[model samples]
Target chain A: MPPKMNIEPEPGDQTPEVGAATDVAPLGRDHGKPAHELTAEEDADGTDWGRVAGESEFKGLLASKRRFIVPATIFFVAYYFALPVLVGYAPGLMDTRVLGVNLAYLFALSQFFMAWAVAALYVRAAGGWDETARRIIERLHSSRKEK
Target chain B: MSTPLLMFLIFVGITLVITYWAARRSTGSSAYFAAGRSIKGWQNGVAVAGDYMSAASFLGIAGIIAFQGYDGFMYSVGWLVAYLTVLLVVAEPLRNAGKYTMADVLAYRLSPRPVRAMASLSTLTVSTFYMIAQMVGAGALVSLLLKDSGVTYQAAVVGVGILMIVYVVFGGMLATTWVQIVKAILLMAGTILLSVLVLAHFGFSFGNFFDAIKHVTYHAAAGKVVTQDFLQPGLRYKPPYGALDLISLGMALLFGTAGLPHILVRFYTVPDAKTARTSVVWAMAIIGVFYILTTFLGFGAATIVGRDVISKNGGTNMSAPLLAQAMGGDIFFGFISAIAFATILAVVAGLTISASTSFAHDFWTNVIHRGTERAPGEEVKVARVTAFVVGGVAILIAIVLGPTANVAFLVALAFAVAASANLPVIVLSLFWRRFNTRGAVAGLGTGLLASIVLILLSPSIMTVDPPTVTGAARHLIQSPPLFPLENPGLLSIPLGFLGAFLGTLTGREPSAEARYTELVVRANTGLGAEKATTH
Candidate 1:
């Protein structure tokens, strides 16, 4: 058999400490603590995995994100499909005038307004979601430190 | 007395004022590169719109529509829809992850050195291709407007280059943003005015307008329908695409927007990932409307203006200018021309700034200056110099290439490069945890090399016969049977993914999952801000 190989850990690796810790030891002590006590300590230590995992605020924010995605996708895809059809099949439809512009021109221009409206809607809806998400993250972070 | 010149002067004056103000405000690197990250959400949204819309949108698409009929609209649709991909995949992640360039985001999880170097190289490549296209377009616009003024295309290019260099060197993002904002508004207004006039010509009757276009048809020439072919009494309307060209064009637009570096950097100007997403939604809305107007302008040019005029001087490319000349006269023509010039300047300025920032912040400061906390003032100085260097290089390339190359072809090459070099790395870095530094380097290198090689061998480059490569030899080697299709997206994008995957498998796994996870969380949730309060 060939000589045994040696593999060294990278300097950037801080994973050994975080990953290898099987039991929560008390602050300033070497003794292992109970799991429930560890949980409270984890929160107090401001690295609370439980709070981060259980945060409902993030769920709410994600829900809003999903809502925005669904509608925006519909509008954008519809517009994309509309292009070839309007040009190839409904040539006459585009030529019809609206506000001194043809239907095609009007629709193209309207797409911008629709985009702005969508943005405005996003801002109004997402503004709250972003703030709430920030709050939950902060709260969890603070909780982790206290333990 | 000419409205065009007056409008042009007015815009120049406004831009100058903004530049001076920006110069005063920009004290260090952060201010020059990213507006000190204090720019409001909505303002950045408008600036994003300004940066994203280029001469291609203002002139190329409209001109294409006027010349090629529906095919032009296909380009417009492709351009706009690609933004959705940007919104979904790139914007928020990009904004949240890194401080400056797209490379910053890609290299965040890895060692800074190699990642920054590679990312800068990609930025330079993409920026150079994109800048050349913009310059070429600018030259064309100048030539069209000043054909009778004794101004050469070279002079036009140089003049625009000077304007762009000055804008970025002195004013930074402030100058870039203000010019873009003003230009965006003017472009929209000009198109809106032209649409109104076109409608008025038809007595505001949409039915009559459609009837006019329905009767219009062009004879097929060289397998491509020449719009002028239809002007005569007997010609028939030949559609621009049969099937193949449509797919080729659609794929180009779809992947192209996702890859553009200048546009991607705009997301960083916003406050957070959420704002970046919102800004994209705004950019999409603005861009969507602009494209729709272009379609009308194109059809109006085709129907109202005689094809004989447009075809005589450069065919479809001159359709919009000719239409402007017809409807608005010398003054109106000058006004539109000036706006077009401003459009080029604004875009080139933004591109130069983004490219330079990638070099300075991502490469020089982050990668090269690793282990050193970059002085605030020094970072800005490096970026400014990089801007000058990038701008100078672009000018040299533009001069070498001259004004003979097609603007659309250059733009397509830019798209191809962006898709190949940047997109694969960006996508993998976000989704694949297995993607390591080696994987990123390989993917970037492979994608870039493959795309460049494909483009060189493709019809565009091969068709240009040189003494070194005889016509017969060129033809023999011109079409590679392996990748019969010229577009690299269908080939290179996959290669990028494959290269990245292989690199990951061969490389060592990242040893710092906890820290990496923490960084990702910090990037995603702005968790680092809490640390700031504690400190």
Candidate 2:
């Protein structure tokens, strides 16, 4: 048999009616007991006291996500804005050669590689912040059980 | 029968067989519409590549390179890079949020009615433009290949339309995916093989190839470049923009790939978010290899066959076919031609399916079935019917417009429409939490209207005459003509962004920040699976 579920339904919970009674009976038997036992013991010992600290820090991490967005927007705008003028008027300015390839071909190809690199960088940077927020949220949820 | 005709018959037979198989298995809407969400990651990944790379990549890029030289390769690079954006930001988020179409994601936070309605309109507009472009491309490909057979361009467009509609009406996504997979494989193999043969003929020396090109002095006035006379050249040919046009073309290539709708819909087929991410990586690899091979083919066409001989008839669309005939005999030429035809078919089918899904699922089923508790199977049936209707409409348009307009030009216009309308709404909805439903609707409407209005009033659309050497076409409408720009991406993309931002400021702010936060958390992490039973 599966473990019992201990999570109580909130007021006016809108769980689907189709398979509700039968499904909840198995879930209660499978998951309810261990979860309730764990919360009760933790509550007695005040084990999850750091939730307040975690919530404040999670808020700080969310603020940093805003910082990366501005620089990214600036880079994209400046890069794209120069395109039409360069294509229309400054073909001669790009006559210099890089390796066997001309500056024109080199710059064009590099833009693709650059876009990918920037996206990877954003993922790496933002991913760190997102992870921190997730951890903080997890910590708060556990602490709320103790309270 | 000629080699191209023989090969075309063979591929058409294979496509028909696959369609029959798909139709037999497609009992209900789920199987026909979303393939019952049972498609594996890698399979969907290849299908995505097939869907994304249309006649634009297979035929248009090579044609552009044959005419314009090194600048054309910039488009290939730009298109490949756009996938990175799709992989990182769009693929997983889209798959996680919506069960089927783009409307699900757009309206997830808002009321189903408004969200579905606006999303459907955006989808229809984007899809129609895209489908018209594909139809135009198909017509051009048929005309180019069958010009010697004494077939009119109108007949060719009608022929392709009939074939595509037959494919869609029978098989749906299953048929489309299989056709795309087969076509993509054939196209990659054909290009790769031709590139090898071209390089081998030139003694496999890159330095020698470049040296050979230096001797070729292209004559613009006579419409032929003199290749043999290096010591004493007859005429000097100079392209208008030396380098800057490279950057403009490159920017258009890069962002335009990300803005495509048929490509975006492929992400929804995967089973989970992680699968979507991995699928993107696979697509990038396949695309990178294919593009590198195209460079070899482009340079080979320039050096070996000589542009003068190829452009004897008209334009660069025939350059690759001519080069194939030169390097390899009639057999290889026929194979390449057949693959090109398949490329057109696969791309058109993908576009038709995406458009149909948007109409049936997003517009009718979601909007019309707003309060109803219809089964998922019923929705799929509606989508399949919508696909057939859309295909019929496209065929009619292609037949009607076959005489005067160039299909390639129409394809470019579609890209411009996609970039102007869809890109803004997608980007804002993901990043900007303040963007309300009213704001999204307004931005989409404005962006689409501006692009359409600009395209209609532009010199290219008005003159309808082929652009001449001296650029001597008079504008039909005299009033309110601001810039001579052909592409509306320069103006309309920003207009879309501004409209959305301004519209958001005027509307009431959504009170579902906490709900959005919870949804976002579920989407980003894999925790939603655990909570499925709770709902």
lDDT of 2 by residue, A43-132 (tens): 223323223323566446645655775676567545544543454355555545556545655565565566556666665675575567
The regions of model 2 sitting more than 4 angstroms off are A1-89, A111-147, B147-155, B222-253, B371-376, B464-482, B512-514, B526-535
Tens digits of per-residue lDDT for model 2 on B1-535?
A: 7778788889999999999998887765556666555566777777787776777787667766665665566567667766655765566667766656766666766566776776677667777877787776677667777666766777777778778887787887778878988888888789889988987886987667656644554565566645542211111113442233344344444455565768777766555566676677667767767776666676677667666777785457667777788899888878888888898888888888887887777777778877453774676667667776887788788776653344454555666666666667777766676777777777777777777776776544555333452221234444543434455666666787787778777866555342455445444542331111000
Total backbone collisions for each predicted model: 18, 16
**First chain TM-score for all predictions:** 0.59, 0.55
Give the range where candidate 1 chain B is weakest over 10 consecutive residues by summed lDDT: B229-238
- Chain A TM-score for candidate 2 is 0.55
Error of 2 at B332 (Å): 1.2
Q: TM-score each candidate.
A: 0.79, 0.80
